[model samples]
Target chain A: MSTLNLTAKAREAATSGDYSELISLVPYAKMIGIECIKLGDELVFRLPAQDGNIGNPTLPAIHGGVIAGFMEHAAQLHLIAAMGGQHLPKIIDFSIDYLRAGLYRDTYAQCQVWRQGRRVANVAINAWQTGQAEPIATARAHFKVD
Target chain B: MSETTIRPRAERFLSVLKHCQNLGMTVEQADSQGLILRLPYSDSIVGDPETGVVHGGAITSLMDTTCGISTVCVLPEFEICPTLDLRIDYMHPAAPGKAIYGFAECYRVTPNVIFTRGVAYQDDRDNPIAHVVGTFMRMGKVTQSEALTKAVNEGRA
Candidate 1:
């Protein structure tokens, strides 16, 4: 398939909210069990509680790295979804702050594109397990999007 | 303090962490210098199938785990330290089919927090795939989970 045709199809998949097709392109996201769902006009990503994703079995907390990875991927996917798959994002840098322990539960994340120029895009992501007001983690990522 | 003593403890620590186990991480070295961890390349970790490159998140996980554990080298006793904040810069994508190594050192340890800096590289430490600086909050000494402890004991037996 031509690269153009492939991107067109990916754009279609994203625009129509065929999240599985979009997610299948990245294997790590699938391996870690990330899913995307649309509520109203916003997209929300979820990481369901899994034994293999735990870090401290004592508190039964989700791994900090897992939380970071999830937020980062969520931001990337959101960027793709937002741009209608016109551009692929390569992460330049990412900074994340952990506000609270991510307990072992279904985690949800939402991303907003803070700014997007021609070559770079900045995204802010927030992840929460129980309540959105009390976020477990918040992150900012810069992606080179051409 | 001693490699012989800390090696087994580190190995046992890695085995119980489900995420570390899932990523197939192994301790290459653990001593006063810091911690060096190996993340074996696998299909499950491939981020871009087109280029056969590993995901950035996998690198983040490896560095995070390495930095978090580096606290053990500085502290007198085991404590439950959680990541406070972390910043990672992706210099480049790791080569496909090559295992990535993460080396982290606890540079500063305050009463309330531990500071760390690390690099993820393949083959050459001079050329890093990514670099990370992180801070972790120092919680009190670990309290073993009964269920996890039982599982570990049963597996050993």
Candidate 2:
């Protein structure tokens, strides 16, 4: 992809559903320590707790920005994997609703591609900390997949 | 608010956010218009290696932080406000090696919610890299930490 220069290894990982190499390709993803695991055909994104990700030390809550960032990347990576490594999508816009304060703990996210057309793709992302039923944040992102 | 009061308050307020410090953001200006915060370019935040463009997530972080804190400028007193929701549009990738600035203004402050809108620009305010509109829930007055209170008093002195 012109947007992201994916190496052979990265491409292979993309097809094999091994996202470690793909995650490392983006510096910010690595900086935030994002990890992915494939559960049956679904991918679940994980963000391990780190001190740098905290927003309010008083509540010890995860920064709302960090939660947004993590959700956005998860959606991007999920889109990449879903498209079979065809191309890297550029985010056009994102709308996120913070359901609850993201606590300072390991967080998880799952993305679902609502629709994909020739030029664009829409993704819905949900992030949770303690349980899947209680999402900390939910977001919809539009990406330019051209 | 006067620059003298807004400056330290902004600095103090930002200092409490650990992620803001991690991103290397600083309060550039705070006035009636709103809060202008800067996010410096860094390799650690780069999204595309080939182009060296900082990640959209970093820009999102800057805008979220900017909009969240902008409520202080409109409110009668400082209150703990949490982001209820945010919408961001990335116009384009920011130019590498240049800092990005977020200017956010709380346009409306209701009894329970505050609305804010802003843009992330580089050198020219007209050409923004991104635009954002966000809402936050007022959580009542903030319970200042002992250290923060002490720091504010010392800063004032």
Candidate 3:
């Protein structure tokens, strides 16, 4: 019963049921809430914190796994939206950069889609504790597009 | 249980990770301010590859987990926090057949949020393979024991 279950558990929750293949084979991207986000694309997603509110003492900061999960979900959602629900893109490479510290406050990630080339899509996403201007972390991802 | 008992944190996130065995991540050290974690080579996965080396997700998970642990170490009680976002930069591929280690430091800790940075390196330790930064959100707090036991009765996301 450890507190650090977000990365893996989120993996389970997102990739559970039928997403095992994509999650297991693709080390780069992870699953989030039944959606799979390519780790390498710039994407945005929002979900209720399992804990309900913002940061508190029981768990002092944001969970790392939760962040990863969010990126994966956001990327997928962005791709789906771009495709008009036509195809699924797989994550090829992704990167993240932490810019500032965030309090366990109501948070969301707003993603910026930079470019999409044949067979690949490039994306950038920002995680904000407050808004896009106050992003604490940023992510870039590449996905294989059909 | 009180109303606050929800989304509990792992009593020993690293220790639990050790039990995973498959992920191949290890917690080398931990304290209030920071943590050191390692990713051992899996028989199927090599560290030094011609393409650069170990998988990137492995490094991300290691960095992310340690950041979460570093946040938990400073907490007075246990709360289930979620990683709002993460950023990682891969300088080069790590060498296979070697251990990869990460050093994570928490820059801030509030009741609801945590911010952190981590660097991953090969055996030399000085030369890093990747640099990582992320934010963890403590959504709510709960008793550790209760959290472990609750799995039997409830379904959570």
Best candidate (score: TM-score) = 2
Docking class of 2: medium
Off by over 4 Å in 1: A1-6, B142-157
The DockQ value obtained for model 2 is: 0.65
Candidate 2: residue pairs that collide: none
Q: Report the error of model 1 at residue B78, Å.
A: 0.8
Per-residue alpha-carbon lDDT of candidate 1 for residues B34-87, written as tens digits (9 for 90 to 100): 889999999998877667789888898999999988877787756667789999
- Identify the CAPRI category of the predicted complex in candidate 3: incorrect
Q: Give a tens-digit lDDT track for model 3, residues A1-146.
A: 23433234334434332333433333233312223334444333554443421122233444444454456446755665565444555556566665655456555776666898878888776777667787777778877777
**All candidates' TM-scores?**
0.92, 0.93, 0.51
Q: How far in Å is the alpha carbon of B130 misplaced in model 2?
A: 0.5
Distance (Å) between predicted and true CA of A131, model 2? Answer: 0.8
Clashes of 3: 45
Instruction: Flag regions of model 2 displaced more than 4 Å.
Output: A1-4, A7-10, B1-3, B142-157
lDDT of model 3 at residue B80? 55
Best by lDDT: 2
